[model samples]
Structure formats: C-alpha cells, structure tokens
Target: MTNSIKPRLLLEIIAVGILAFAGVLTKTAANVAFPAMMAAFHINLGTVQWVTSAYMLTATLVIPMSAYLQRSFTSRALFLSASLFFTVGTGLIVGAPSLALVLVGRVLQGVGNGIAIPLMFNIILMAVPRSQRGMMMGVGTLITATAGAIGPTYGGLLVDRWGWRMIFIALLPLLLGSLVLGLVTIYGERRPARQPFAFLDYGLLALGLLLILLAQNGLGEAAPLVSLAEYGLGIICLFLFAYRSTHTATPVLNLAIFKIAAFTWLALTYFTTFMVFFKYVFRPTQ
Candidate 1:
C-alpha cells in the first residue's frame, strides 16, 4: 500500500508542478514579448505595459470567485476547461493579426492562470494525506517560486531566438498534457451538484473588469485623473463585492476565511510586500 501510494503521490506532485509551470508560462511569454510587442505595434512603453497589466487586472478581478467555481465543477472538468482556455488563448497570440486580438488572448490566458493556481492547491489538499500535507505544501510553494524566478529569463531567451510567437506555441503541449492527466487522475473524485448560476456575481465581476480596463487605458494615455476615477470605481465595486460576499448566505467568495488570524496576517503581509515591491520598481532613481 505504501509503495503504490508513493507513486500516486509523485504523479500528483508532478501534475501540480506542471500546472504551476503553465501559470508561469503566461507571465513569461508576456514579459519576453513585451519589447517586441511595442516595436511591432509601434506603441510607447506605457501602452505596451498594458499587455501585462490587463492580464493581472483581469486575473485579480476573477480570482475572488474561484471558490464558487470549485464548488460547482468537478476537478477534472475545471482543469480541462482551464487547459483549453489557456491553449486557445495561446494560439490566438501566436496567430494574432492585430494588437487587439493579442490583448484578448492575454486576457483569456490570465483567466486560465487565475483558475488553475487555486484549483491546483485545492486538488493537492484533497488528495494528499494530512500527515504529509505540510511537506506537499512546501513543495508546491517551491515549485511556484521556482517557476516565477525563471519565467522572465526563459521568456527572454525564447523571444530572442524564435520571436514572440514561439512563447505562445511552446505552451500548447504542456496544457494538453495537463488536461489529459487531470482527466485520468482527478475525474470522479468528487461530484458536487452544480448550483444555479448567480447573475449578481457575474454582474459585479463584469463591472470590476470594465473598471480595470478603463483604468489601464487611462493610465496608458497619461490621463492621471481619468485613471484615478476608474480605479476609484473599481475600489467601490470591490467593497460591494466584499459586502455581498460576507452578508449573503451563498457568497461567491467565502469571506469567513478572513476571520482566521493566520490568513488575516498573511493577507496583510502580502499587501505590504506587493506595495513595497511595486514602489521600488517604479520609483524614479536619481
């Protein structure tokens, strides 16, 4: 029994690692192609930055609903869907005839990445034993961090050697393999009845995404006031989302997670670290 379980656990770890790689691939591809994208589109630095910023904004806006999605779909179904979305988006970027289509592809890839990361964690927690969960979690974090660290360098190399389209093309096999493995290993593990779709959640998500888009566009154009207003509206939507999440019985995001002291502190730390990093990166040097 132990021998058999070991192989299965190894496979699960490999699957999670691959999923993390896919998430990192999206970022790597974008970073690698950013300079080329600007040159090809004849856009300035600020405009080209949107290629990455838009993806992040979209991902952040959608990530809050991941818990609801996990409840509504089987693991296999969700993983497959994420793979397909990511692969299709990658294809779009590869075959894009215009900058607009490329941006659309980036947005789709962002959604896939946003969904896949949390789902990977959920699957690991479900499959791994309690006694070994800590080890698995550490491994997962290491995989994620390693991917992030190497992503930019790999992307730069690919873009330099084969042009920007190769970055997208490179992801196709990984996504397909992940889809196949997920179907084999994770299918039929759980069958929660799908709940009725919530229109309110969709509405709020759309509004939030729209605000992010507007803000990105405004910022690109150097319209600080317009960007500020757009971001302000986005904050309002987030507050509304928080209120609905907490007060409603069938909340999209489980607000109760924030009540855990550890989670609360982690969230605070993450926010501070992100702000500090961004400030350092963007600050003008003398």
Candidate 2:
C-alpha cells in the first residue's frame, strides 16, 4: 500500500477496534457491577439481573436482522446510529433514577452494540486489502479479547473506590473518540438498493430468541413448571423459524451456514469456551 493509503487504513482499523473494545468492555464490566447495582437500585438478584440479561437478549435479537440492515443502509449511517444509541443509553444509565430506566438504557446500548459489532467486521473486510485481512482480523480479536479479559477487574476497582456509574463515565472519553473517528474515517460505502423485508419471519425469529433468553434467565428464578413451559414454547418458535428459513425467499438468518462442518465445530468451540470462562469468572473468590 502507498504511504498515504496506509495511514488512512490504520486510522480506520483503530477506530473500529476501539469501538469493539468499548462495547465488549461495557458488557463485561456490567457483570461485575451487578451486586452494586442491585444494592443501589433496591432490587433483588432476580430483578437486578434483567439489567444484563435484557441487554444480552436485545443485542442477540438484533444481530440476525443485521444482514438486511447492512444491505439497506450506508456504513456511515449505521455507524452514526450505533453511536447515538450507545451514547443515549450510557447517558440514561448514568442519570437514571429507577431500575426501569436503567433497563431501558441497557436495551438501547444492546441495540447499539449489536449494530456496531457486525459493522466492525464488515469495515475491516471492506477497507483492508485481502493480503492484510488476516492481520487486521487478528487485531480485532486482540482488542475484543483484551477488553473481555480486563473488564471485570477494571469494573471491580472502579466500583470499590467510586461507584458503578463511574464505569460508564470512565468509558465516555473512549466512546466519544470512537464516534469522532468513525464519522471522519467511515465513508464511501454507498447504500444498496432496499430489499423487501419479511416482517413475519423477523418477528418469529426475534420472539423465538427472546423467549429462549428469558427462559434461560428464568431457570432458577421462576418456578420449574413455568420455566419448562417457556423453554418448550421457545423451542417450538425456533423450529418454526428453521422451517420458515427453508420456505422463505429471503430469510432473516441464512440457516445454510449450519451445513458446513467447520462452522458447526467453530460454534461449538465458542460455546465451550464461553461456558468455561463464565464459570471461572463467577466462581466464588475464596
């Protein structure tokens, strides 16, 4: 690459990496801050957990729809929207008076996060050359992995010395830098022609995912029978979604990826890694 192009590409990668790191940090930090949040909000463990679980559900729900969204929207537009949603969510959480508002804030942040993660990957693929793609991906992984590794420790220190809100507050400068750099560097992708969006398919997929997350959360908190019923309903909806993907012209999620053996193995590996990490992180400190 030319010297001029190299600097520009570097800046773009840096911008995307920073945002990804911040998003991951936000999620992991909240995990550590749960006890403090519960105490301050005057809520029980079951209720306080909605703060994190709701965000996870919202983010997960938004991801499948991203393929269509990226097709219909400009990269700049998507980045700006993501930044706005995240900023407003952070502001709300920082100033929220009640648990409800905090949950709302978390959902908005989740939406922003959902949009931002895919955009980060897409940007690297679009802007970086094929020769450099692998290197850039490694950088992306490093940023996210480092953030995930350190978030709880950082959050714990802040929570102990200051408060939970400080976590969000401390993140503001990095978030703002990301927004500014994104606005400056993320340009040139023209919007694609809008495709017909299948509302019913999307609704079914979203509802299915939502119920699954809710049921997962409810396992110990809700009665066993109620949890079982919710889990059953979620499974039914998911099966319907899988069936719809086969029949529909433009399914929100392309289930065909599952046909690849490597993809399935990769997914299983991710799940196993997450479970191990979660157990390690949340195990009793003693």
The top-ranked prediction according to lDDT is 2
lDDT of 1 at 68: 78
Stretches of candidate 1 exceeding 4 Å from the true structure: 1-6, 209-213, 220-222, 275-286
**RMSD score of candidate 1 (Å):** 3.3
- Distance (Å) between predicted and true CA of 72, model 2? 0.7
Cα lDDT for residue 173, candidate 2: 89
lDDT of each: 0.72, 0.81
For candidate 2, list the clashing residue pairs, or say none.
Answer: none
lDDT of 1 by residue, 17-60 (tens): 68667776556446657678777888866667677776777677
Residues forming the 10-long window of minimal summed lDDT in candidate 2: 277-286
Whole-model lDDT, model 2 = 0.81
